[model samples]
Target: MASREFLKILSSARLGDVLAQQKLAEAYLTGAYKTPIQPANALIWLEKSYFSVTNQELKDKQTSSNSTTEILTQIARIPLAQTFQSPAFGFGWTSFWQLAHTKAETQLHLAAKWQLANLLINPDHQEIQAQLMEFLKGKNISSSLEAIAGLDLKGLQKIAKQFLQELAETDSPFTSAAKELLIKLQPKNAALSSLWISWLDDKNEEALLQAAELGLTMARLTLGLRLAQLDGGDTKSNASLKKAAYWLELAAKDGDRDAWYALGEIYRRPQFSGYSAAESDRCFDRAADLGHAEAQLRKGANLWRKREKSDEKVRGLQASYWVWQAHQQGIAEAKELLGKILESCPDPQKNDWHELALQAEQAINHHVEHQLDEDWLLLCHRIVIANQFHFSKAELLLCEVGQLQHEHCVVVDIRWELPKILPRLIQIETIQQRRALLAAGKVFASSDLEIEGNLRQRRYRFDRVTHWLTTTFAKANKHQTNTELA
Candidate 1:
């Protein structure tokens, strides 16, 4: 199926035409001229072409010691001089000594050395193992041995060990690569494990990456954390974040609690990997289930905040349940929130409610006596206002304040008639101040607030809100005073 032109070129190349040989090599290498892609055949033809050109050049030069010495010096400067030195050139060196009495340094000699080395390293050759050993012992051909270490051939463990021993004997440019190859070829062992850990402790990134790629869970998790902590907003930083996520996810799949938590944190930040609220929640929930205490508290808080916009009563219940779980595990913030939820339960007359209320009272007293700060006192008042209103917007405001702990001022406009002494609309900063203005209980204590709009935008009656606030604040004040006396 060969074209006439291709056959003509092949015929010319086989007849020792150097240009035709080079062209034929290119054709085979690239599968041009309707030739089959054959890398080995291409290297063979290229070597032939190179040698043919070198022979003609030598024939044109004067057979003088000075000329031969100049050519040898130039050959020594070839970038691959270290790679192309071979024991096969021993015959050529003897011939050179008898003639010009100088070391062999022709391009033909160099090309043959490199081509043979490349062919031996190409794993497809059946006798590569033997050839590799011979080449390693040959003159200045250690670079070829290094290339053999990089090949993914089976039964190279012994060869790799030899490389390690030789590399350890002296410093060389190939030492680091040799070490990596030896590690890859050898089975994982305690000594190697210790070595890798030491490398990691020394902040050797290449070693860490190699260990991670070898499926070390801890290494993967650590690398992920290191990548995630890289500070920047540039393209490289984003790429690092993605890579961090990949490793963290891998570790998490292997049940790494910290990886799960870190993944959750990363997913929550939109700039890092594009935010996915659901994915963030899922990761946090998984971490919490794995007994990550911070994750537990964060999951609970996220659920609690989401309840305001969610119409499902189960969502609020789950929020309380998680907060209680976190509290039982000794998270201070969760304990505070659990107490607030129990004490502010809408139906306090139920037996279950009464029991929870007692627990809440004890928890709140403990918090106030031991962990109370001025900021906490202000936060507690805000919580009371948010609970009394039972409006989504108010709950959102409380969530924001809890998260940020910044000063917030808001005005409530109530469309209802009130006593001249009572203000229909109020601008307030703290729940305690609102309680003071509604202490009379003439309006808010009697009826439920009429609210409208979606859950996030619902409004409430002025009297009903004030009544709830007055009752809640009074109970809180009494409980605190009693606890102090006790």
Candidate 2:
């Protein structure tokens, strides 16, 4: 039986209100406000609460310069930002900064999980013991034990692991913390020890199978690839490949590029009875997207081969983009193919390339709008990205933040704003270009569209901002021309 106010809070929770959800979860867990004690229902709301909190944090950070600096710092640290990671790492590191804010109550949600992870790894950790005691005492004072359990022991570990895993994937201090806890959480079994030895020698089939079953992604990948490469004439080859595909598919879902490439190879093996070119190509495409260099070359060649006659320019642009990526990674074959590609695919620039966005951003120093109006601030960010991407005025004004992004390009289609204007795909060529795109996309995704207005209204707003930018650039150019003439 629920009270009217309790049902109202539940309604708000269902509508994605994090604070409301947290409140309901607390009330349910502790039997607060005469609500029935139900740890399972509490876990349900708590999960929703954390996820919603994350979404809200992102939305809030969209307008913060602190967030921008943090994001840029993270992106600039990636090992292969230029070729392998155009925009993929851009999205990942941007998501790294999670909910660590001034709100003490909301933070307890994460703190509790962090302590639980610590305690899971070291059951006698005195610091964690103190922290957990403080947490349970602070939040409604009882039945926090049931809240952790979600009414079962396995459920508690799953929740803790999931929480830590999400933290580990990001580029925050929590990432290392989450990773350390997760590593220790793995069972200290004979199978795991055997799997460690197999990494170097790889002869122990029984050891590999046990570790793969225990959910080690690298073990699955190693075993699957080893199985995939077995002689096709073996009587068990078909079954081995089938089993290889199964394990490789699981590893691929975990974002292992090697697993994706192996799956591609297995599917394309001519001797395999269940061979499917379409499926093989799909796997290769995914592998290429994940930054496997050889897969990029294969994907590029495949695209070149299947290019549509009518849409040659578009298809060729797309193909050459992948081929160009492979060429950059010292692929000799890709370099030869790129020579052919360049004949059909003209260079993307008419003028020598300049990072004018970086210069313009420095000149304007427009981040101040963060203190003024968040919408205006994001508009400034979008303008910087548009300049970086070499967007035309119309494209800059009309492009949807999220829709235009591709692996190698941003699709700028503004026919909805001006039917006479055609759409185009602009290449994302630099780490800086990817950085700009991530910045704009991060902000604009959370902006209020109705407040931003219709296309015509947006155009007027763009024109207003465009005036100052043009004036500044024109002045700079005129000065340069005079200096050159002298």
Candidate 3:
């Protein structure tokens, strides 16, 4: 909700007040009054203020308008892999280019040109790929980009390439990014490079920086690691860590798990100016999600250590799930830790989880072997929910999925089954896990009254479905073994 004060400012802005317009734009740009940061909306009022001041209206407000416009321009100057989700994306390039071009009477032109050129050539992101069709049709073409092209595709790319080359020749924050994009755009250079990635580890600063600028992940990663090293705990040595973070963040954004892990370590260094345990955990989690075996084991171990939290047993189960993922990736430490954890925790039957998943898919249908396949489908949903959220069997069977959702966790209350049992809170973890829960919740949402009757009837249904699934799995398991042997 827009605050009453902000609403007054908005009303005044709509009534042709230039100061109100500028204030409203600033508020939108900076998310003032709990407003969502909407760059497109900011640009609208800003453009109004810009031309208004240019027309000799409110001359005193000129400098502040210019400063705000430049800030918006910088925000528009994002990376080559940006997902274009806003009209502000179009306006950013346009506004940023004009601002930078005008400011380019000095050194700031390089930043503006870097953004315009890269955005023209290098946005091969999957999200942008869909819009290539629109680009082909010339539908949604911005005039600034069209003007920069100087000709068709060939001249457009050539102009962009020239801008990148010019930017790289100068030293600035965008220099490395410009060079990396140029290297990526030119396959010939990538093909001609004969230097082994291993050689980067022992390379000098100049050699490493040059190669890293040329989009070699190994060189950039090595350079970042070298810079991130402690310099005898000198608090004044923050410059090195900042530079390291810049290079590492680029690699991490490009989906390098190793870079993500390294970044996590860098964030955790006590001597670093920006040391943050929470940021370190987020980086490690990203690495873990990207299938880093060591990260998975560490994440699992960390979760297990915190098992004495709210739902201790459920926490242990959740921790085991991460360890299980690590085990599949062939981590020896994960296997050892998993063995020890399983020794203390009660797990389900030793059937392959993948195999059980397949069986669930097979059994959740009209069955030739039994008339209880319908209930078995609901049973599969229950099993998936229990395994995902680490709910108890009774909670899985009795808790209403719709009713149990809290902000960050699921409230599993089976006091309906056993009056003495208290409600337990289980935190939602991954998006995949959340999706699985939502899917199961949807099934139970549409269920008939018979499917979710009294507690005694529900338990009886659960028992029948379990028997059916067990019997079916046994037959299929034996048949598969016999076929493999024969």
lDDT (CA) per prediction: 0.52, 0.62, 0.67
**Could you give candidate 1's per-residue lDDT for residues 286-311 as a string of tens digits?**
99999888888887788778777877
Question: If both were scored by lDDT, which would come out higher, candidate 2 or candidate 3?
Answer: 3
lDDT of 3 by residue, 1-486 (tens): 889989999999888777788788778767888877776677667666555556765556877567565544434434423425554345454555564546333445666677667666775544554563355345354444545433455555576678888877888877878876776776635433544333545545666676676667777777787777633444335677788888888778768998898889888877678999999999999999999888888898988888777365344666766786888899988877776554321233332233444455466543455554455567777766665666666777787777655444566777766878876655554675677667777877777636566778777877776666668786887899999999
Backbone clash numbers for all candidates listed:
1, 0, 0
Clashing pairs in 1: 444-463
Which clashing pairs does model 3 show?
none
TM-score for predicted model 2 compared with the true structure: 0.39
Tell me each candidate's RMSD, in Å, in order: 23.2, 18.4, 8.7
What tens-digit string does per-residue lDDT give for candidate 2 at 191-254?
A: 6877758856867778778777666888888778777864343434677889889889878977
Clashing pairs in 2: none
| Winner on TM-score (1 vs 2) | 2
Position 137, candidate 1: lDDT: 53
